[model samples]
Target chain A: MAGIQKNISPTHIDILKEVGNIGAGNAATALAQLINKKITMRVPEVNIMSFDEIIDVVGGPENMVAGIYLRFMGGIDGNILFIIPYRNTLNLLDIIFGEKKRDLFCEFDPIERSALAEIGNILAGSYLSAISSLTKMLLKPSVPALAIDMAGAILSVPLTYYGHVGDTALLIDTVFEEGENLIKGHFFLIPDVDGYDNLFLALGGV
Target chain B: MDVVKVGMADLKIVKNPQIITTLGLGSCVGVVLYDPEKKLAGLAHIMLPDSNNSKDNTNKAKFADTAIPYMIDLMLKKGAKKERLISKIAGGAQMFDFKGKSDIMKIGVRNIKAVKENLHKFNINIVAEDVGGNYGRTIEFNTNTGKLTIRSLGKGTKEI
Candidate 1:
């Protein structure tokens, strides 16, 4: 395994944080609109972490989460994941389906699953468009794939891609909130290995 | 009993009453090797199927091809007999799927195949496995009983 390069400059982290800020801001807004509630977010966190450390950010590998995955289709290639805790998933479903009716115990119905996927699509679309405008690059997002599983298992997909190069992942984490509840959703932007170079080059890096 | 944690692209060995574990295994596969007589076990969280494609293959525990041998060598050093070794594996999950995705999206399948092939090369018998699904899993190996317990989100837990 290649040692994780601790070479990401502070400037690069700042730029990535800015990118995350704009993208997640748009996503939070779209979510807020869908639920007809006020949404707030913490300042986006941009950092490079090993796969293990990344798992810790979401409450460890065994913790259950609902993850939304989208592959980037143009100019840049990578995976974008929006993760929400199982409890938060239920909360979002409740808001979308308007209940007391949706049971958290049972499996999500097909309609509920579709609703979740649509929500993921909307958020990813908005986020990508914001970054597209910022970098003057056309970014297309694939239809979202939703997985409800242990955080480690859900993360294995992208980690394997990065494993061919290095074991570290440069990620942008944006935390979302709804009123006092702290909805506990995060958007993780993981650019592919080569996609990092492309991202920096497009962002005025030498 | 002490518990040793094996992170992604990592491996560990433990003895009787102790446990070795790896968490959040989506496309990654976890291979556990146990020697019943010695009461010793080794676990690896293999990230990719092959190390030849990697620029640096120094981390022997990161790929199925390399990790199996590395693990066996460690087990031997810990008094585990190669002849008595048996394996149990878990956690090669697809996680998500979409139409028109490239073959690389099937990394979980590739990883499982690679692990099995490598174990075969080492002549280790695979006694049990819980793999190949669209969900993630966390696995633990109990060195005492050689039980591999698999845990998944909302799917409950099972032991093999």
Candidate 2:
């Protein structure tokens, strides 16, 4: 195992970025298939960042967002978060369930919330599977949990794990776009400290 | 009129009329210390309870065990008397729920306890706090009046 006390090396970062690119690319394709639309995604932004800096990555800590949270239960431990702007969430829900009797944009009923979770599950699962194939590591994802709240609050939940180890966290950030920018969203993969060595070694990057 | 922003695992000290703020404190504790006579205040948005086991020691302000003492020392250096200091805190919320409780899920409670323990170590009295729920909070502290205001989505603003 690599030294946990040491900062990430340049080579480690490069390898992780490549992994992110492959994973996010697969996830984006999966999303396009689910919605039956041409979805585009930007290159993944992979870096080791502080908790504070991450708040700014997805707009800001106070920005209201809809997040789908899932835990990686096997192989490597980590958290996968799918964050979409509240407005984008409404738009996506419209596509999933179509226009209906929903009167509010901020609040989501149970069914709408479930739809969002399902979408998140599909996308995150796709990303994980791609990474698993590349690394030859067995990976399993837990059920998804949804939250519609300030980005800070939602992010902090998973961040607690990293906080105990160090102030810096490795974030693989990817942006997804659908239908000429009708929908925009972010995906974050935050692996635990130990998981980093396990993953990199499994991928033969170490 | 200057509002200094404190980031997670960060701390800041200010005097008179200056406000210090931290946002998006879900399951994290925001500790605000104020000296009424000097009108000096310090805010520490600490992310975790202890740094005793962490291999990385670069960020002292990121943990409750280290941040409190660091902020107090800075405040005293800025001419604020420790004997006159009082504390007001906010933002220790359990953002999600699970059927079987895990230690990670109880981070908010652990953070609150850690903050209080550190305060007690310095003999600082905690005057007010708004904590322990399933929500996120943004907090601001006024050095002039020593007021801490808390804000959250859906819930209205609250003052501690």
Candidate 3:
């Protein structure tokens, strides 16, 4: 574990960033098609940080968000989390259902929750497929699970999985934007510790 | 009056007039050991059930098995008697309703169980607890009153 951390060169970060670029690019395309709107993405940021810092990246522990989680197994092992702020979730629902009900504290009905889950499924599928094709690794994503709650709580689930091996986690993060609506969402790709070695090796790393 | 924030996989001990807090506990458990008479409290935001599960266990506060004992030792050094300490725990919620049969999905339950077992091993009685749900919780422990205040989104705030 120490060896992997010590050996993460700048080139490795760049590789991970490029991986994020491809995966999120494909995901952005799917999201754009689903909402029938133009979408833009920021350059992916690859960070190695502690569990607490990771929570702050998603808007602190108390920030309310609609989080979609999935675990991938097979060629690589890791978790993918797609998080949209609570307000953005309502905005997304408005766009998908073609309605203007923008209640701040409105409850998400069963259908609305399912719709969000399906969106997560499609986006994550595209994202995983992009990575799989890039590395020629067979990555199978589990069913998407949705949780609408505090960012800290939702993020803890994934961090705990990584915490077994190390105190810090390396993540590739991407942000998506919608032009007029200003709706935004974040994607966090966290590969397990062993998966990193395989990923780096598959990308021709020593 | 000052709130000392405890980060994830971290621990802190405070004396009177100070409140200790940990935010966004999902599957993680926030264990608070308080000595009301001494007016001292220690809080640990434990992430995993056991330190032995990991190859690297340098961070003692990251696991229930290691964190509880470590905090107890620190409290004892600061004049908190083991007999006077009472436990109040929060967080350890299955934040998502995952349908898959993955072991990680049951992590919240496992964490809660492990925390209980560790506390039992220390012969500390848990006075109050607000745990086990599909929600995230942020908790604050008051050293002066030995009150654990738990806050959750849409679930309101309550003291356990």
Q: State which candidate has the highest DockQ.
A: 3
| lDDT by candidate, in order shown | 0.86, 0.85, 0.91
- Taking every candidate in turn, the Cα RMSD to the unseen true structure, in Å, is 1.7, 2.5, 1.2
Give the per-residue lDDT digits (tens) of candidate 2, residues B1-160. Answer: 7999998878988888899999989989999999999999999988888888666656788788999999999999999898998999898888766444567778899999999999999999999999888888999998877889999887879888
**Best model number under lDDT:** 3
Provide the clashing-pair count of each candidate structure: 5, 0, 1
| Cα-lDDT of candidate 1 | 0.86
Error of 3 at A66 (Å): 1.0
Model 2, runs deviating above 4 Å: A1-11, A100-105
Model 2 clashes, total count: 0
Worst ten in a row by lDDT for model 2 chain B: B96-105
Model 1: docking quality category:
medium
Docking class of 3: high
Give per-residue CA lDDT, model 3, range A137-204, as digits (tens).
99999999999999999999988877887888998999999998557999889999888778888898
How much is A83 displaced in model 3, in angstroms?
A: 1.0
Give the range where candidate 1 chain B is weakest over 10 consecutive residues by summed lDDT: B95-104
Is 1 or 2 the stronger prediction by DockQ? Answer: 1
